[model samples]
Target: MTFKLTPKQEAQVSLISSDATHIMAYGGSRSGKTFGFVRAVLIRALAHKSRHAMLRYRFNHIKASIVLDTLPKVMELCFPGVADNCKLDKTDWYYSLPNGSEIWFGGLDDKERTEKILGQEYATLYLNECSQIPYASRNMAITRLAQKTPLRLKAYYDCNPPGMAHWTYRLFVERRDPDRRTPVANPGNFAAIMMNPKDNEANLDPKYLEELQSMSESMRRRFWLGQFADVTDTALWTLELLDQQRIVDGELPDMVRIVVAVDPSGVSGEEDKRSDEVGIVVCGLGNDGRGYILEDLSGRMSPADWGKAVVSAFDRHEADCVVAEENFGGAMVQEIIRSASADSSRKVGGQVPYRPVRASRGKIARAEPIAALFDQQKVSLVGLFPEMEDQLCAMTTAGYVGSRSPDRADAMIWGLASLFPAMTKQNAGPNGARSPVVNLGYKSMKRKRA
Candidate 1:
């Protein structure tokens, strides 16, 4: 394959080759940032005795995303069979080029692997998705960029902008120490460039751009427009809070109860392109006393399709029940779930445990209490859910500014609220008497590994 750089990618390459010791590429998704960065690093790795490291917050992510996918794709497309001549060190997770250059990969979360990688010196250290990586890890990794190689020592960082509060924004964009909040000594040494999806429009599908265009305002700015987020104070949830609460998929606790909450859009799956997306979120109340949001399956789907999705998610998680809003479809949602749930091959329909919830109040009104639990640090998203999280951040004390229906966030709230019944809005009794609310509290935090 003939290699060529898009205008945005060429600009990124020029930035990497600059005098700045700490270079960062950030902005929206699929702007060819990673491809350009990886290609530049691989070029530097061509120098004999050159040492480099590719790293991320988690080992699995680096391996699956960069090591197994991006690296090889770049190698074949740009470097042309350089991969064939290289030997991958499966044990340490790196590639040993025939020219005596070595590129190592490690996850900061894996202490043993991190220690091993950090023990060695490197000419280049590329921190993929630096937003998820802690400042401590970045600092420690920077110390290893001290190898006496022909190439200049440099540290490369990239991420889809998380929020202004993230270390990347503080250090690169604000030119301040991430932890101390003090001014950085040499501001020029830290350089960052924003590369949104639009900058690489020629390489992206029109439909993909349309998808980005349709994202909630916050997400559109962060991922589509490629800008740092400025979450409002009145907003019940901020990106910073969500970042702190994110746990890897392996950290979920044994679930006492799991529910799949469906917020029906009242549109068929095959309906017009402008129809609302059905919100399908799976949430669990952990035995360890934290609320876990397991998945976001929200999308535009027909009644039968969404019904199958609900049953599929229920079967996969062995959820205790299906909690869906009855405001829109009434009995239609129930019948679809029941019908799709039928195993026609066996001539029997599975009796799915269903609970229909009524929305008696506005979205933000019902979501306020659920959002409070997030502030209390009692909610753990079992991995990243960008769309759902974006919707959450769009919600304020007054109203929601995230999406058309804000269905995903609503579904998540319903699933979690069902787990903590006391937090959910209760139907008023005679004389306006409501059910007594239960205190939602936890003693301490504990880690559970899958």
Candidate 2:
């Protein structure tokens, strides 16, 4: 069987088709990446048919549906002679070669399952959609393929750019030095084959490309153009939702129970100068059940300086309790605030206490559930803090960490969550104590797309 290669696929295969240790094929969707890599693996396995060869994907089910089901149809067109032998079975996602070279399919869902197949030395390893597998799993799979001898073992990893934030991308794609790494036109040495949608001009449907162009600017940039989307883009929070009438400033309303959120920085003196601003916000719920952010004490300062500032926010707002992100400084942040309150000059009342919650999730994930509350009209922001507002508006689909200015959003999450602890009950620890979901400085969580 002979399948025609798109110009882009042909170029990429030319670079990687040889006696190489590794071949990295990365490109946009429908670039014929999978077919090219699969063809190489199948041909190599046939060359050493007596040995084992396996085609793997993120999961066995996908391998069955995609490779086992679709690949043979394409193979029939490419190699008409072997079309009769290409059979899809329950466990195997490939076919049987006449030379005792049996093509099998496997999934990399868990280490235990993957390890089960590692006992046999594989003549060729085909990793379909390599980006889906976690870095840890991919590395383990590679190490397991230690060759027994002259059988010759080679592996091919196929995927597209904007790979999952998995460690695989950092180690392979990002670290590959084009200058030092000798480029091969075939499967010889470690080579990265680059392909763009336009490169496969002959096969791609014109309507599909035009449809991509018609998408929203953000969507086109991320999905079609293969760019990283911002944390705020498509985020649940939007400027329009933060109704101006809901924003309250200057002084918080009388004792509906106020919460002050603190994001304390551990750095001191000159070191603190370059660090992010330690944010402190005082907020409270109103009679109507809406939330109000009355004061902001956010800026870069030494621990002592920030502690004092936190105390001042508590005193000024007569805050009911202080909620602090305790991941870095932990209990020490509480101690600092307590010590600052005891000082004669400050004498902050009620000890300027710290909740000391430790964060277990990313900034966006933590903020997400809270953002839902606001979206559902369960929480309301009082008088807009423009700086905080700016950060919220700039947040993209990736999360707030990308922008490096999650302070305002972080402070807001902590302040609101303190009053509504039940809001995050699902993520609570074994002891029923909630993880530090919010603090002053916001850290973003990694998100996976379908």
Candidate 3:
């Protein structure tokens, strides 16, 4: 079998063959970093009799991603027709090669499993998705990189560049001692290389590039361009702030009012060229008077589809009402909600209360109070919502700089405003003056209760 690797993969293979004690292959998604390093590990394991370990943040992730996807493909590509020669121990998650070399797979999240892995010594250590592994666990694993063998003792790390604040950036890219906060001029045995998706274009789907191009600038830089971007000062919200105020499920008191807020996308049909997402967020005012974000059901859907989603969230949470922004579609938005609710398949009987909110101010102006609420510790997230959190963090006082519209953040703001009317009134103007609340003009349409 004839197999040809891309130039970047060839370079990575060469690096792996060298005597670098700590080697890193950082790059964009599908840039062949993992496959290259896996191949290198195989070559080293096959060439010498040594024990090696492959690790990720979680054991299940390794099993699901590498063990099920990449490793088999690597074996087929590198060692053609040699499958029968390898012995895989499913119980222990290790494989024994014909050359008396063994490779073990483990995760850092499991304390017992991590301890067992740390107890053993290894000639080679491959930390897959190293960005997800904490610095403490990484430091602990590095201490075990000692196994008596003819093969050179080395470690390979590969991950799409995370935030610049990550330890990987400080240690390898900046060549700084994380603990001492000092630079190492000669970083003797450490080396790092950046690879972009374009470098290995042949292996990726043609549509993948387009998808990456459509991503937000911050996400594009980190995933498609392979750069460590500082997300702290540039963005209004940080991961630390969100994590600090995050609440576990079922930790909130009984809610006084639960509202599902919607930021409707203008695209009315499925065939519309625009793919703008309809932001639907479920939030509640707890008995303690604190706001708890329950869920984010935002998605790119037509008017009918998003209306159904709003109805579903209303029923699921037994919400008081569905508050929708009427900036895009005035009365039509309410009609869409009614039409979707009237569907027999939905099992929704009678009228669903719909409140239309018109945005009289800019997004940033309306979002300021919400951001203030978060800062004041009046708002808490019930669970992790990566996409929603990303949008939330990307929003700033000036405006949202994310690639897509911050519909999710907008919906969250609306929900909070409904619960805390003071947020819409106090400190709303530029000079700390109260801003007049936009009259919603409460008009109720009579319908039988479901």
Off by over 4 Å in 2: 1-3, 50-57, 92-94, 148-151, 163-168, 174-189, 216-223, 226-450
Q: Spell out the clash pairs found in candidate 1.
A: 268-302, 269-301, 269-302
lDDT of model 3 at residue 358?
83
| Candidate 1 lDDT, 1-450, residue by residue in tens | 357788888888888888999999998888888998899888898865788999988787788788888998899898886777899989877899988999999989789999999999999999988767878888899989899967899888998887787789999999999899999999989998888889988878999999888886777887798888886768888776675566753345567677899999867666556887899999988776789898999998878788888888887876767899999979988888778768432122366779899999888889999989987878888876778887888899878876477889989988888887767646444566655423234222322212
Clashes of 1: 3
After TM-score superposition, the amount by which residue 205's alpha carbon in candidate 3 deviates from its true location, in angstroms, is 2.0
lDDT order of candidates, best first?
Answer: 1, 3, 2
Return the TM-score for each candidate structure. 0.74, 0.49, 0.69
Better of 1 and 3 by lDDT: 1
Alpha-carbon deviation at 21 in model 1, angstroms: 0.4
Q: Cα RMSD to native, each candidate? A: 7.0, 17.4, 9.0
Which structure among the candidates has the greatest TM-score? 1
Task: Write the residue-wise lDDT of candidate 3 on 75-98 in tens digits.
Answer: 998788666799888898898899
